[model samples]
Target chain A: MLIALLWYLGAVIFTWALGLFLLWRIEKSGVKRWGATGRLFTYK
Target chain B: MQWYIGAMALYAAFLIWTNVKSLKMAESASDFTAGGHRMGLLLGTGTTTATWVSVASVLGIPAFLYSDGAAAIIGWMAGWIFGGALIPIVGYKIRRPANPARTFPEFVRMRYDMFARRSFLQALIGVVMFIGYLFLVNIQATGFGIVFSSITGVDYKVAIFGFLIFIVITNVGGFWSVATTDTLNAAVIAIGCIAAAVTVLLSTGGLGNILDTLAVTTAPINEGGPALDPGVLLTPTGSFGSAALLSIFISNSLGTPSSPHWVARMLAPMNVKVAVLQIMANVVVLLVIWLPLIVMGLGAKALIPSLPEGVATDYVIPLLLQEHTPVLVAALTLVAICAAAVSTGNSMLLTCSTSLYYDVYLNLFGRTVSDRALKNWLRFIVFVVAVIAVVLAIDPLWFLAMGFTYVYGGFGATFSLTVFLGLYWKRMNRAGAYASIIVGFVAFIIATAADVPVPFVVAVSASAVACLIAVYATKPPPLESYEPFFEAEISESTKVAVERVLKLNPAQQSEAVEVRSV
Candidate 1:
C-alpha cells in the first residue's frame, strides 16, 4: 500500500513538474510562433 | 432536483456571461473561426486539453476500465501518446501555409489546388466532418442525460434539452467563447478528477487493495459461459481478445489527427513553436488527468464487485462518488462530468459550423455572403446541428467509447495519409489526395460493414497502399503547385538570390521572370 501510494505520488509530481518547466521555458524564451504569446493565462 | 437545478443554473449563468464577453471580442469571421489566431500557449493548451478529455474520457474510459481492467488503458491511452508524437510533425509544418485555411476542408482545397470552386473533395470532407461532430455532440448529450438523471432523478429528455440549450448559447460567441470556456473546463476537470482519485484511493484502502481485489474477481464471458480469470483483464488483450485491442489502438492513435475538432485546436495556436508545445503539453495533461480516473475505475471494481443487474459499468464512477464521497465532492464531480461534455460539445459544434460555413457554403458554393450574414449563418447552423444531435441522442445507437472509436477510425483512415504525405512528400498530388480520401473512407466502411475483426488496421493499410500507388503512378503537379509547402525548404542562398533579383527594376525583373518562365 505504501509503495502504491509512493508510486502515484511520484508520477503526479513528475508530470506536474515537467509541465511547469516547459511552461517556464516557453515564457523565458519569449519567442512567438504563428501568433503564440507564451503566456499561459491570457489568450493574447 | 433543487441541487441539480441550482448547479445547472449557476453553470449556465457563468457560461452566458463569459460568452457575451467573448462575443464582443469576436467581431470578425477570423476571430469567430480561429480565435483570431491569438491563442497563447496557455490558452491553447487549456482548450486543447479540455477538448480532448471529453465525457468519453471522464466517464466512458473509467467505465471501460472498471469492467475490463488495466488493458483498457493501453487500448485508449496508448493511441493518444502515439497521436501526440505525430502532432508536432504535421501541426508545425501545416501551421505556416502560404494561404492559411480557416478549416481543415479549406486546407485540403487550398493544398490540393482543386479545379472546381466547390470541389467534390471539399464537400465530402465537410460532410464527413459534420457527421463526425454530430456523433460527438450526441455522445456529450447522452453523457449529460445519464449524469443528470442519475443525480437529480430528472427525465433524460429534459436533461438533454437543457444541456443542448446551454451548449448552443455558449457557442454563439464562436471560437472565442469556446476557447475561454474550455480553459475553465480544463481547470475544473483537472481539479475534480484529482480530488475524486484521492478520495477513492484513501477511502478504498489504496491502490494495492484495489489490485488485489480485482485479481480475484471473475467476470462472465457470456450469459451462459464459464467465468474467466479476471487476471486476464490486466493484460494488453483483455477478454475482448487481441484483435479488438489492436483495432482500438489503431483507431485511437492514427485517427486523432483527422478529427476536425482537434484539428481546429491545432489551428488556433499562435505559432508553430506554440503549436508544438501545446501538443506536447496535451500528452502530459492526458497523463495527469487519466491516471487518476484509471485508479478510480480500478478502485470501483474493488469496492462494488457486483453492480445492480441493469446498471452499466459506465455508471461506476458516478455511483462510487455518490456512495462514498461527501456531498460537495460528489456534486463537484458531477459538475466536472457535465463540463467535460459541454467543453467537447461546444468545440465540436464550432468546428462543424466553421466547416459548413467556410468549406461547404462559401468555398464550395462560392457564396459571397457578407461577414455579418456569414456569422448569423454559423449560429443558425449550430442550432440546427444541436437539434439533430439531441434527436439522435435520445436513443444513442452504441456505447459511448465504442461509437467514438468507429468514427475515429473512419476519420483517421480518411485523413491520415493525406495530411502526412501532403505535408512531407513533395511528389504527392491531387490524385493521391483524392485516392487516399476516397479509398480510405470506403475501405473503412466496407471493413466495418463486413464485420472484419481488425477493421481499422485493414482500413488504414489499404488506404495507405492506395495513396502510395496513386502517388507513384501519377505525375507530380507543377513546382508552383508545391510552392506553399516547399518554399520553407528553400536554401538561404536561393532565397537571397530570388530577393535580390526581385529588387531589380521592372524591366530587369520582367526579364528575370521571362527567363524563369522559360
Candidate 2:
C-alpha cells in the first residue's frame, strides 16, 4: 500500500527544497560575520 | 582489476595528501576532535553526508531490496527520511551551551552534572559508546571486506586487513583529516552511485520492465530454494510480510537522530545556526545518494535473475559493478562503495576510541589527565579497536543490515530518549536521566533476548515512560542544571565550573588523573 513512486518522488523534491531553504536562512543570519569564530576545544 | 587498482591508488594518494595537510591544522586537542569547531558549510555538509552513507546504506538496503522487493524501500525511506528531518531539533538543543562540549561525554557531564561531577554517569556513557560504536566499526569492516574482495577477486579474509590500515590513516590526522577526506569521498560516492543507477535503469529497460519481471518471477535467490512466490515482489507486503517491514521503518526512524556520532557532528559546526543549517543542507545531498541506492537495489535484481547458490545477497551491488555495467561505471561505483566504507570507518573509529579512552578511562581515573597524554592514548586505542573489529567480522553470520537492528535498537532505547529529554525537558533531573538509561537499556536487552518484534520500538517506548516517571518522582534539577539550556546567560558559578572541567582540574571527590609511572 505504501508503494508509490510518484508520492516518494514528491517527498524527495520537498526535502531537497527544504535543505536549500534553511541554507538560505543561514546566509541571512550573517554566516560571514561569524565565520568559524566559535570557542575552540583542546586536549588540555 | 587494473582499473580498480589504479583508481584506488589515486584516491589513496589524495586521501594521504589531506591527511598530511590536516596534521598541521590540528594545533590543539580540540582541533583533533572537532575541527576547532570551525567547519564551514562545504566541509560540514560533506562530513554529514559521508558518515550518513554507511555500508548499510550502500550494501545493506539494496541487499534487502534485492530479496524482498519494493516493500523494503518504503520502510527504509519512511524511517530514514523522517529521522533525517529531526537533525535540527537535536542539533539546536545540544549546541545551546555558550561553550558547548567537544565530545558527547563532555556534553552529558555539562548538561546533567547539575550543570557541571557525575563520574559514574560519564563512565556508563563511555561503556555504552564503546560497545555501541564497536559494532559500527565492525559493520564497516564487514562491508569493506566484502566489497573489496568482490571487485578485486581477493580473499575476503586477506582483503579485510587493508581496512585496518585505511582507518588508521584516516584517524591519524584527526577530525580535520576525516572531514577533508570524507568530503572527497562524498563527492565520489554521489557520482558513483548515480552512474550505477542510470546504468541499471538502462539495462533493465526502465522501472516498468523491472516490475513486470519481478511480478511473475518465482526464481529462487539460491539454487534449489523455495520456488513458489510469483507476483510477491510487486505486492505491498512482498516476501518479508508487513510486520518485518514496519519494524525496519520504526528502527531507522527512531535510530538515525539518536545515533551519537550524528549528534556529535552537529557539535563541530561553526555555530548553532551552522549546526542546523548543515542538517538542513544534508536533506538534499543525502537524498541524492539514497534515491540511487534504491534504484540500484531493485535494478540489480532485474538484471541478475538469481545469484549463485552460496553467494550472499550483499554481493548484489558489487556483482552488478563487476559484470553488467560498463568498465568505467563498475570501477567508479565500486570505488564509491569503498569510499562509503572509508568515510564511515573514519568517524566510527574515532567515536569508538574516544568512548573508551576519554569517556570511560578518564572518568574512571579522574578528569585531571592532560590532553597531550590523552591524545597519544586515543591514537593507540584507534589502532587497537581497528584490529579487534577486523577480528569481530571474521565470518558473515547474516546479511549486513540485520546486524544494525541490534546496535541501533540498543542505542535508540538506551540513549535516544534521554538525550532528547535532556535537551528539551528542564524538569529532567539526574535521577530521571539515570533511570531512563538503566531502564531503557535493560528493556532493549530483555526485548532482544525475548525475540520481540521490532524490539527497539518497545524499548524506546519503555524508556520514554521511565524517563517521565522518574523525572516527576525525583526532585527538580537546580537552576544551574536547566539555566544554561533555557536562559540566555549562564550563571557565573556555572561558567567557572565549565572552565574547571575544560581545564581538566584534579577532582576532590574522584580519584586523581595522574598517569602513574609504569
Candidate 3:
C-alpha cells in the first residue's frame, strides 16, 4: 500500500515538474521557433 | 430540498448574469468566436482551466477513484495532466501568427489546403469536428442531468432540458461570455474542492488512517462497484497492468494537444507569451483541484464502505455528502460540480457550432456572409447545437470518465499525428492528413468496438505509419502551405500570400476569385 501510495504521490509531483519543465523548454528554445520575447512578467 | 432549490437558483442566476454581460461585449463575429484574439492572462487561464476540467474532473475522476481505486490516478489524473503539459509545445506554433484562425478547422484549412480547389480536408475536418464536439457535450449534459436529478429529486430527462436554458444563454454571448462565466466556474471549483478535501480530512482523521482502513477493508466501494481486493486499492495501477497504464496514458497525453477544443483555447490568447503563461496557470490550478479529489475519494471509501444497493460509484460523492456532511457542504459541492459540467458543455457547444458555421457553412459551402450577419446567425447555430446535445444526453451513460475517455481517445487517435506532423514537418500535405484521419479513426473505432486494451496507442501508431507513407508518396506540399509554421520569419511574398488567405473566407481560398464578398 505504501509503495502504491508513493507511486501516486510521485506521479503528482512528476506531473508538476514535467509540466513546468516543458514550459521552460518552450521559453528556452529561443525566439526563432516560438517567438517568446522573454516578457512573461510584463504584458503588452 | 429548499436549500437545493435556492443554491441551484443562485448559481444559475450568477452564470446567466455573467453571460449577459458578454452579450454587449461581443459585437463582432471574431469577438464572439475568439474573444477577438486579445484574451488576457487571468481570463485565458480561467476559461481554459474551467473548460478543460469538465464533468470528467468534477465527477468522473472522483467516481473512478471511488470505484476503480488507484489505477485512475495514472489512467486519468496523471495521463490528463501529461496531455496538458504538451499545450505550450502546440501553443507556440498556433499562436505564432498575429491573425490566427478562431476555430481549429479553419486553421486546418489555412495550414493544410490553402490553395486547393474545394478541399476535401476542410470538409472532412468540419464534419469530424461537429461529431467530435458532440461527444463532449453529450458527456457533460449526461453528467449534469444525473447530478441535478439526484440532489433536487427532478426527473432525469426533465432536469436535462431545464439545464439547456443555461447552456444557450451562456453560449449565446459567444467567447467572451463563456470565458467570463467559466472564470467564475473555475473559482467555485477551486473553493468547493478544497472544502471537500477539508471535510474528508476531518472525517477520516488523515491520509494514513484512510489508507490503513483500505488495507484492511475488503468490502465493495458500493453495492454496484467492483468488489475490493484488500491489496488492490493501494496499488499504482490497481487492476491495470503496466502496459495497460502506459497505453492509456499515451492515448490521453498525446491526443489532447491536437484536439479542436484545446487548439482553439491556445489560439484564444493574445500572444504566445499569454498563451504560454495561461497554460502554466491551468496546470497549477488543475493540480490544486485534483489533489483534493484524491483525498476525498479515498476518505469516502474509508468512511462509507458500502452505499445502498443499485447505486453506482458515479454517485459516491453525492451520497458521501448527503450521509456524512452538513447541508451547505453538500449543496456547494453539487453546485460546484454542476458548474464544471455546464462550463464544459457550453464550451463544446460553442465549438460544435463553430464547426458548422465557420468551417462547414462559410468555408465548405462557400456562403457569402457578412461579418455583421455572421455575428447574429452564430447565436442561432449555438441554440440548435445545444438542443441536439440535450437530446443525446437524455439517457445518461453509466461511467462518466469512461465516456470522456472514449471521445478523447478517438480525437487523439485521429488528430494527434496529423496535427503534430502538420506543424513540424515540411513534407506534410493533404494526402498525409487525410490518411492519418481516415486510417487512425477507422483503427480507433475498430479497437474501441473490440474493447482493445490499448486502442489509442495502436490507432495512433497506425496513423503515424500511414501519414509518413502517404506524405512521401504524394508531391511535396507548396511553400505557401508550410511557410507560416516552419519559417521563423516568413518570406515577404509568402506573408502577402498568407495574409491574403487569412483575409478571404476559407471557402474562397481554394481557387482564384475576383469577387470578394466576405
Best by TM-score: 3
- CAPRI quality level assigned to candidate 2 from its DockQ score: incorrect
**iRMS of candidate 2, Å:** 6.1
Clashes of each: 6, 3, 0
Tell me the lDDT of model 1 at B144: 80
Q: Which tens-of-lDDT digit does each residue in B1-518 have in candidate 1?
A: 46656766777788888888888866666667777555677778888889888878889888887777776776676665665566666665666542345578766765665344356677778888887888888998888878887788778777777677777777888888898898888988888898889899988889888877777778542233456585765665667687887788789877887666666666666655566678766777777788888888888877776677666666777788888887777777788888998999888888887776667666555556555676788889888888889889887777777777888888898888888888778888888888888898899999999999888778878988898898889888645444555454445444443344222211112221110000
Model 3 scores a C-alpha lDDT of 0.77
Please give, for residues A1-44, the per-residue lDDT of candidate 3 as tens digits: 44444544565465556545645655575553243555434334
**Candidate number with the higher DockQ (2 or 3):** 3
lDDT, model 3, position B106: 72
lDDT of 3 by residue, B1-518 (tens): 78877888999889878877778876567777777777888999899989988888778877877766777787787777778777777776777765567788778877888875455677788788888788788888888887788888888888877668778778868888999999999999888888888888888898889888877777776566567777677777776778777776777677778778998898877766677677767777887888888887878888888877877677788777777777888788888888898899888888888778877777656677665677667778878777888888876654787777778888999888777878878888888999999999999999988978889988988988998899899999888777877656778767876677665674333322121110
User: What DockQ, between 0 and 1, does each candidate earn?
Assistant: 0.13, 0.15, 0.34
Select the stronger candidate by DockQ from 1 and 2: 2
Q: Positional deviation of B298 in candidate 1, in angstroms? A: 0.9
* Ranking of all predicted structures according to lDDT, beginning with the best and ending with the worst: 3, 2, 1
Clashes of 1: 6
CAPRI docking class of candidate 1: incorrect
